[model samples]
Target: MPGLLYLFTLCNLVIGTGAFVLGGVLAPMASALGVSVAAAGQAMTAYALSTAVLAPLVLVLTGRWPRARVLVVSMAVFALGNLICAMADSLPVLLAGRVLMGVGAVFTAVAAGIAVALVEPQRRGRALSLVFIGISMSYVIGLPLGAWLGFRHGWHVPVAVVAGTAALTCGALAMALPRTISAPGASFQGLGDLLRRAEVLWTLSLTLLYFVAIFCVFAYIGPVLQALLPMSTERMSVTLMLFGLSGVVGTVVGGWANDRFGPRRTLTVQLAVLAAMMLLVPLTRGNHALIVLVFVVWGIAGFGMMSPQQSRLAALAPAQAPILLSLNTSMLYIGTALGAAIGGPAALTVGFDRLAWVGVPFALAGWLTLRLGVTKGASWRPA
Candidate 1:
């Protein structure tokens, strides 16, 4: 079980790293391939879209398979996808690789979450957060490492590293994870039935809106920092590291808060903090130190929303744990895609300094949806 946890974490690390590393390499990749930066950036959108479209469908289709076999196969697919990415010289091939990786990423997350729940229901919140720490670590360490490699050697180096990691994770899972079948009666119909509930719809809506706000600001963060602060590139990297570190702390804190105070209160407080921070971001211009401080706050508030929101979704349809969790993952990626799509155009129109303002309404909307869910008694209380 410990080995399985480590394998799951490693798989998530590779997937999360691969998913966002392209952002740092977009300009170089575009120039090397003789394409616009916008075209290169589409690789991220493609990956997110594929994840959103495939997560629930794939999980439902393969829900009855042995857990260890499913995990190994998923990691293998991810390894192949990263290998393809490392070898690709054209934008289309790159996008194809990203799409393949997206499917594997979603599958890994769904299977891992189900596994965690099965391991211990009482500790599900902490278990899920531990699995998600891979994502937080990617931002904290993986992206910076990828950026350094891409800048010094070439964009392909980082992709090769991710591919290697994926292969290693596959081997670890195959050797360590226990073979287990799905719970009796767990099927696509269970997922379909869960989705019919109003509470489930509300939870998903909140998930979508919160991600839209978080990703919109995050997607354009580079330009926003450049425009607002007079920091050197190295300084900007350090600031991003601070944000990532704070995000790791925030995820842990959110999980603790969820277990202690319940998901409703934790989510509400986090959303409110996020909205306030976004609104104050523009005011932090002209002071690099202040910008860093604001980023720490933003990271704490923004990332703190993730665990509680996911926990809320899990509680929404407890019977269809795998499918509900998978759909929540899909909503997150869809929100990310939507945020980037809308934020890019908004930045072009209003400038990056105002991008923070653009996220305010979405954050408010997320808060409102969450409040509605709470009012409707969708929140779970431990007895």
Candidate 2:
């Protein structure tokens, strides 16, 4: 179980790395593929939309398989997707690879479900916290390193690294994870029953809205920064690393808060702070120090919500935990696609100067959703 935990974390790290790799390599990928930067950005949208659309299909198909076997196959596919990405010579081929990677992302929820299954109920939050640190570390180490490599070598080098890493983690998971079948009655069909609950739907809606707000601003952060100040790729990488480092702290604290207090209160605070950060971004335009400071707070408040949200969904529907979690991931990427889609056009129209203005409403709406719909005046213990 411990081995599965570690190996799954590594796989998630690879997923996290792949998620943002294209953002960093946008210019180079665009140049190489003979497409515009906007076209390259579409690869991100393709990856996200594909994940959103394919989640149910993948879950339904793998419903009866041993989770370990499912994980192994998924990781192999993920590696193959990255390999295709590394070797692609045309825009269409690259987008296809992105779609393949999105399909393989089903394993992320599977891994989270497996981790939760292995731990006691009371410890699930802590266990998930440990697992999610891989995501934060990807921001801190994986993203910057990929960007640095992309800047020096080629865009393909970073993706090739992801392929190699995924392959290694696939081997580790195949050996480490037990070849045990899922508990009886844990079927994908149960997802429909769970979603019928108001609380469940509201929780998922909050997840979607939160990411939409976040990615709206996040998708164009590079352009926003470049517009505000002349910065090198190395400088941008380092700045983003600091933001990621803050996220690591936030993830740990958010998990502890969820288990120690409760997800409702924790998430309320996180989302409120996130909304404030979004509002403040427009004011910090010219001052690099202020912008960086806002980003640091944004990192904490933004990424912090994830662990609590996951814990909340699990608590709300433990019977449907796996499917619900998978659905939550689907919602997450759906929001990502929505954000990029909206953000790109809004940025183009209103300019990057006012991008965060559009994001603020979504953040506040997320907080309101939790407060009014999910929590309903519930009290939680303080840490």
List the candidates' TM-scores in order.
0.92, 0.93
Ten consecutive residues with minimal summed lDDT in candidate 1?
181-190
RMSD of each: 2.4, 2.5
Question: lDDT tens string, model 1, 1-383?
Answer: 34455555666777888888766566567788788655566677778888899756766676677766667887888888889999999988988998898888755556546655655555666666667767777777777677667766888999899999889878877887767744422357766567766677888898899888877767655567776875554666677778778888887888778778888788888888999989888898898888888878888877777677667766666666666677778888899888877777787777778788898899999988877766675444421
Question: Candidate 2 local accuracy as lDDT?
Answer: 0.80
- Candidate 1 segments exceeding 4 Å error: 1-3, 181-186, 230-233, 377-383
Roughly what TM-score does model 1 have, to 2 decimal places?
0.92
Candidate 2: which stretches are off by over 4 Å?
1-3, 181-186, 375-383
lDDT of 2 at 131: 79
